[model samples]
Target: MSEEHNSRTAAPASAPEKVSLWQKFRRWPLIARIATFGCGGFLALFILAVVGGACLAIMDPEGTEERAQQAEDDRAEQEEQEEADRQAEEEAEREADEQRQAEAEREAEEEREREEAEAEAERLEGMAEVPGVEGMPADEARDALEDLGFSVDFETDTEGGVWDASNWVAVSTDPDSGELIEDDSDVVVNVTRPEDEEAEEEDDEELAQEEAEEEQSDFTITQEGGDGWSETTVEFDIADNFTMNMIRNGARRDTLEAIEEALEEHPDSTRIVIEGSFPMTDQYGNTEDSVILRVFYDRETVDQINFDNVMVRDTIWEIRDGGMIHPELQE
Candidate 1:
């Protein structure tokens, strides 16, 4: 066993063979070998470039710093470009939003104007201008208003005694012509009779005046006293059965004549009190005499009043019971 061991030792013992990377690469498939070689080549080039760059930096410090500065500047420039792009996008979006808002407002204004125009058009549809009727005859004015689908109302002017529309002339209209009104509106025609025509009935008026004078002689002074004539009050009695012409004249005319006679009789009287009454039957046929007229007129108020023309009740100082028969008097 010693001789065998000496023989094994005499022959050089062979070390185990190590496999090289080149040989291992040679044993790989064609595609894997190409991929491995390409990867290894790139890695070797990268290592060489790194070692060479280190050597260059050590040899040329200024060039190394210039290259680093250039890289930093490129990075900063890229960031600035990105920021500019982002800001431009934001500004474009804001402008678009503003434009949309402006368009919406314009549309809303256009709609409102259209609605208003339509409303105005509707308002002016069936309206007509009121025609001039003043200074025209009452009947002619009424016909003209009726022709245009308008109802006519006649109002008598002060000093107007004639009730016939054909005999009167229109003084004015309520709407006063040339005003826009509905076609179906009411038009008031104020009319009056000419004074020259009233004078034409002088004979009849003179006869009536003679009769009034005859009637005034019957008005007896019932009572007369007040502060020793400084402010004298005169009360007169009027006939109850007195009538002024059957249908042509009013009963108030006799009462007015009685008042005038009292004033003439008591010129210095401050107040003239005249009262007259007629028998009134109620629904139950109970007949009783109630004071239907009372007149309290001061001398100053009577001076301003026109006794010949019908005195307006409101124009008088104080009047009660069956007020004035004038057209302008309210109830």
Candidate 2:
């Protein structure tokens, strides 16, 4: 027995051999091997992905969360900016539409005003028929004629043989009553003052003698030089209606009398030229001091006229620019 045991112990011990995974796989069936390999490869890739994610999280936990938050904030900001731009665009469009509407309204209003003005002008033109002014006061007659768009020229006969339009009564009018005339035609008004019978009787002899003398001393006017005449210029400020009337009644009368007296001394004088200018109304019917007047004639004839002999009732005539006289030809 002892010899049998020694023989068993003396036998060589042999280690168990390990089987390789490739050899195991090589022993599998074709379909089973393919499935097993696929499953094993999938499992290995998933394990590697989990390990990589864990490593990244451990390296930068705060940075990863910050990057995600920043990306979300950027998207929100972009959306807000886009919304603001849309609102601004809408506001601009609304303003532009309003401006266009306002412009159209203004243009329409102007067109309406123009049409109304035209209609008013037509109505006034059609109603400009002249009316009779006989037996009316001189001022009333003038106003009446002017209301019809007619210019008025006044003449008065007084007991003193002097023309005083301010205190005269209109007797007759040129072109007569009920005469159809142009809107801007001139109308001559003849006016005379009433004379008292007792006064006339008291001064009959003296008036007869004065009349005889005046008839003998009256100067004759003739156009011997083919309507040639002497010219003079007078400038004065016309502030209002009162001043205009004063000029017409006082200054114009004195100037004409002076001219007549001067012509009496010169028998060769043919005529006397007179012209006047005043402020013109603008588009708004406002007057300004831009009027001008000029008279042109023979210089030699004007030199003989004596302006100093004239008698002005209200205002005095003074030469402007040291008595400089500018002459121009009549159109």
Candidate 3:
């Protein structure tokens, strides 16, 4: 009976109760409780995140790679767009520069054309009117025309009764008078001798005939005894005045007269040789010496002597073309 009573009183001590997490958390102080709650919330969030990531990975395993590839494609597209934009900007700039340069060139050409037109108008305005110089001395008329800024070219009119060019008078003009002409234009002046001088020429011709009649006696026969042939050689210097007269009048009157006189003196001669030389200046600023020799045969008669042989026909043509003619030939 005493042992039963002690066992009942000592009642068997129960196994120590285990403290749950929530029970221990509830037993903490206020600050420790807050901290424990915070830590617990953070741990719970971390576990949830881990579970959500695993679920996503299981649902679509390639989702991460797709997102990365989309990001890379976005970056590449952005770079390509930027490069295209840069090129377009550069092209626009280049086009703008070219347009500006073309505009400048066009403006420059227009300005040049305007200047040329203005200069031409001014030149035309300054042109002078040609004055009449008929019936004036040839030299005086030429001087007057030249003073008015004209290039004077003189011509002799034998049919208009011109004999000596030294005292000749201008008969007409090519462009007439009161015509507006540029300074570079050529003015041709026709000249003729005074009426009084023409009357004296007839008397001179009669005297020349008488002198020829007297000179006929001076011809002497040569005894070379070669087929009974007689030859005469004559040389004459081509005077500048004579050359000029021939170029202007188209006839060497003085030379012909001298030859006529020689032929009248030696009518029996069969062959006649003539030699001449003249110096002239060409248009190219070169000095040329012209030499000529011509032989004439009495094919018909002395009165109708025919030209047989000629040397340097080109030189004669050049002289006829007024290349070797004096500027004052038709004075």
Candidate 3 residue pairs in backbone clash:
none
Q: Which candidate is the best by TM-score?
A: 1
Reference-based lDDT, residue 187, model 3:
94
Show the lowest summed lDDT stretch of 10 residues, model 1: 321-330
Model 2, residue 113: distance off in Å is 2.2
TM-score-better candidate, 1 vs 2: 1
TM-score of 2: 0.30
lDDT of 2 by residue, 140-259 (tens): 888999888889888654445435555667778887878777788999888776553345566997899898988752323223344454333333332235554554454345334434
Per-residue lDDT of model 3, residues 211-258, tens digit only: 999875322322121475766544455555445545433324333443
Model 1 residue 181 CA deviation (Å) reads 2.3
Candidate 1 wrong stretches, greater than 4 Å: 1-36, 129-173, 176-179, 187-331
**lDDT (Cα) of model 1:** 0.70
Give residue 10's error in model 3 in angstroms.
31
For all predicted structures, in order, the TM-scores are 0.38, 0.30, 0.30
Q: Model 1 over residues 1-331: C-alpha lDDT tens digits?
A: 9999999889987899999988987999999988988999999999999999999999999999999999999999999999999999999999999999999999999999999999988996877777888778888989998998888888874564556778888878888789888889998887777664466478779999999988656555554565654333333332344443331133355456655777776677666665555465779999886555555666666676677667552334244322323221113
Q: Which of candidates 1 and 3 is the stronger one according to lDDT?
A: 1
